[model samples]
Target: MKQVHTRFPVMETERLQLRKIEVQDAENMLTYLQDPDVMEYYGLPPFVSAEQVLDEIAWYNKIFTQQTGIRWGITLKDEDKIIGSLGFLNWVPMHHRVDIGYELNQEYWGKGIASEALQAVLAYGFETMELERVQALIEPANLASIHLVEKHGFLREGLLRNYEYGNGKFDDLLMYAILKKDFLASSK
Candidate 1:
């Protein structure tokens, strides 16, 4: 792919806005990240301080500048409030692949925000980033995430054993990938 731009115009969907994580989001970001249930599938222990959340937001800002991958703050368009976060985590330029991950506040569960954010990112990855594939490494126990990816037409490749350490034990990973061709075909 050609040299990529680190930031793009804010993308607006029907109900959400996908934009770069900013310092202003630290407070609301904590509101979601600090939630035990929200962090459960994301390998985060309960956050004890808002400062810790700010540190994470700072880290995300650095990641954005480095072009490692973009972390978007998902916000309600009308309310203009951050409800969750979703973005590309691991990006491999040489391999033309990237790892996807996201978390939503428990209060916002079952509302399809995760899916909307995910779909937007996947489209951006394949179309804007010109990637060959984008995959999510989700813990199998996170059934909702697995189904979310499935609903987006990401195919289950296989289970990657002991792919991540989480909660307390080594967890098996469920791999779901959507190749550019696959994404385009599914859209058609």
Candidate 2:
């Protein structure tokens, strides 16, 4: 697999633009990251300061430089403000696998924005990244996210008991994944 480290890859969908997370996006990113409803299943506590969001933006850049993964800020085609973010994480080029994660503003829920963004990201992961598998670890109670991945043809693998710790105690996650072959077959 070729490492996309030299330049940030920018992608576009019919209604959205997936681009690098810039410092200018901090305020918009904070808008959703600070929303309790948006952060409920995000594993992190609601951000209370711009400084925390800045650190997050920095992390996005660091991961890209390290070639560990990439995170893209989601914005409307006609707007520059970030309304959400989605991307691959924990990338293991040797294993041809990575974890997918995303979050959107509560206001954008149920509008299919996430589904659209996810479709584009998955295509990039399997095609450009040459990923064999892309997995999403979603909280059991997040029915919306579960449905989103399932709609994209992700199969439920199993429960990962006490998989992650955040916002206080450990929580369980349901593992869902889609293989490159399956994705291509479905698209065809």
Candidate 3:
């Protein structure tokens, strides 16, 4: 595959805008990242400071410049605050594969924002990024996230034992994936 653009490409949906994570957006992003409920299934503990979010944003930019992967801040069209963040991590252009991850504010749960953002990213992964396979490794307990990926036609490939060691314990993860062909067919 060719090299991805160094700049984070902004993408927009009807109700949300997916753009590069700005330092100014840190506080808004912390509204969810620091929420215990929102970070329940996450491997890392809830963020305790805005500085942590700033570090995360810096990492996002670093990877984008390296052409590895990109993460976008999900913001409401009419609102200035970011409600969530989503993107592909661990991109392997040679293998045409990438891992997807995302988190949203609890307030936005069940409102379809996650779905909309995910669908747009999936389309871009397949069409724009020319990815053949996109995978999401979700904790088994995260039913909502599992459902979101399933709605996009991601198959439950397998359960990896002790997949991630975090929060003082080894966590099991359920791997879900969608192929370019399958996603395209389902979108029709």
Candidate 4:
């Protein structure tokens, strides 16, 4: 029932914390953003410098200030470094919907860290933001990501052919979504 606020919200899970991405985070983010395995599915090549990550952080803040989206840096409670980021983009207030996207360091891939971060984000999106639906547009080839969303109860609506023009050519994207009612019910 709470409304989303302009200031970044701090979210916590059992083992991770989701905080606003800041310029100081660029060095930590570069660890995964530059890793080929981590950014393999990204539309562009891996970020090569901390400056690029700074630019990205600026963009993240821009969207948040504009009330369009929010991006959070995922960090383990025991570790001081940021492992990755997850967020909602293309937010439409009238429709009460937003697109979700996320990435994690390869070293932490199998540990369920991504899931913990996502669960917190989803809760805020539905409970605080009062969103009606949350959607994910993933690359068809990214089976791991596909499975991640599916595990969280997102239903695959369909595929968008040439949905994204990335890596020099058009790529197909699998659309998945979950409504607030369904999410709340499942959490019970």
Return the top candidate by lDDT. 2
| lDDT (CA) per prediction | 0.82, 0.94, 0.92, 0.89
Off by over 4 Å in 1: none
Which is the winner by lDDT between candidate 1 and candidate 3?
3
Q: Least lDDT summed over 10 consecutive residues: which range in candidate 1?
A: 1-10
Predicted candidate 3 versus true structure: per-residue lDDT over 1-188, tens digit per residue = 47867556898899999998899999998889999999998788999999999998999898787778899989998986889999988999999999999999999999999999999999989998999999999999999999999999999999999999999999999999999999999999
lDDT of 1 by residue, 153-182 (tens): 999999999988877888898889989998
* Superior by TM-score: candidate 2 or candidate 4: 2
Between prediction 1 and prediction 4, the one with superior TM-score is 4
- Candidate 2 residue-wise lDDT, 92-138, digit = tens: 99999999999998888999999999999999999888999999999
RMSD of each: 1.6, 1.0, 1.0, 1.7
lDDT of 4 by residue, 91-185 (tens): 98888999999999898998999988888999999988889999999888899999899999899999999998876899889999999998988
Off by over 4 Å in 4: 1-3
The model with the greater lDDT, 3 or 4, is 3
lDDT of 4 at 91: 92
Residue 103 miss distance in model 4 (angstroms): 0.5
Top-down lDDT ranking: 2, 3, 4, 1
Q: List the residue pairs that clash in candidate 1.
A: none
